[model samples]
Target: MARRQVNPRDLDLVIAAVHAVDPCPADQEAAWTDRVRERAVSLYVLGDTVGQDIARLDAAKQFTATLLDVRVEASSTRGVLVLRNTSGSSSSSSGPTAAIPRPGGR
Candidate 1:
């Protein structure tokens, strides 16, 4: 193959940009794990909190809004953490309600 000329300036710029954004692997990995865990907890807690709010609502719209939020969280299967809700109404369990993680959740 014929030798190709390289742009030293462009290469140096790329190197500088990469160095500017360098992250400690261990620290970043830990941070990412923590964020994922936090998001999972937030999603779970959001459903429960909305359900609690719905319990106190008499208007259909208010109750429906909260219910919708809960339903979305209950049904979410995408992402690293999957939350499966079981309830007589949810079709997952023949009971009032339960939130269970999918297999291999941890």
Candidate 2:
């Protein structure tokens, strides 16, 4: 059970990249990026190989892009986070939508 070491600078780069592509507000972007980084660290600690954790981070980036696209395209007032089923039976287009409460109840 060796611990995987991830460079903090690398994590910062990933967060910056996601924020650049994300349409969410600055506050939301910071929060989501932190959450994504935490998840990647958790995965790495839970026996995921370094490559697996990197892939997971990549998927998180993709998720951010998809969520932003969906929200903009849907013209949603409430923040919408799209959840994709990873099971082989579901396609990305058929994923479920979760409404996120926007800041200041907007």
Candidate 3:
């Protein structure tokens, strides 16, 4: 039996699907994020270099990290996720990773 090759685009779809779903209970959120992160890493490790899959995987990892941060903030604040830009810096010296705001304020 042969293993099937996984596409990096599929991982993007998975991330979008996860984002589309309503927030799960706080207890389960970590598991979901962990699983997604693990899958993304695994795909990255197994992906071929011909298609720039590595770059896509890197983007996915960043997206996953931002998602996890948002989930944690939402859970901690009881669903109110507030994002503030500090000092108009493009990159943060230290702090949480910047997240893209969801449309319609989520």
Candidate 4:
């Protein structure tokens, strides 16, 4: 018996497939966003190297961007990091480790 190593690309494909299935109902938008973030992070940790693939990463970013965009469009006040500081929170891990975003704009 032998343990087989999974290719990083295969993880990305799995994450992509997860997104395609629409895990949550329409009214449960937050849950849907959470799912995407969770899957994205798992993909990242699995060595997906999204930065190396602009198009694929861009698709992931769009999910976060849309969440932010909706907040802005609503004209309601909400802190981006404050809202997402949990499991699917936006943080240093979301971006390049070498150039992390500073808190409160430094």
Model 3, 77: alpha-carbon shift in Å?
Answer: 62
Error of 2 at 41 (Å): 0.2
- TM-score (all chains, Cα) for each model: 0.27, 0.22, 0.25, 0.27
Q: lDDT tens string, model 1, 83-105?
A: 33333232122223334444566
- For model 4, the stretches where C-alpha displacement exceeds 4 angstroms are 1-21, 48-106
lDDT of 1 at 71: 26
lDDT of 4 by residue, 70-95 (tens): 12112323233213333565442222
- Compute the lDDT of residue 102 as modeled in candidate 1: 46
- Which ranges in model 2 have alpha carbons more than 4 Å from their true place? 1-27, 48-106
For each candidate, the alpha-carbon lDDT, in order, equals: 0.46, 0.51, 0.50, 0.51
Candidate 4 least-lDDT 10 residues:
65-74
Worst 10 residues of 1 by lDDT: 63-72
Of 1 and 4, the candidate ranking higher by lDDT: 4
Candidate 4 TM-score, true structure as reference: 0.27
Residue pairs with clashing backbones, model 4: none
State residue 83's C-alpha deviation in candidate 1, in Å.
Answer: 43
Error of 1 at 95 (Å): 34
lDDT of 4 at 103: 42
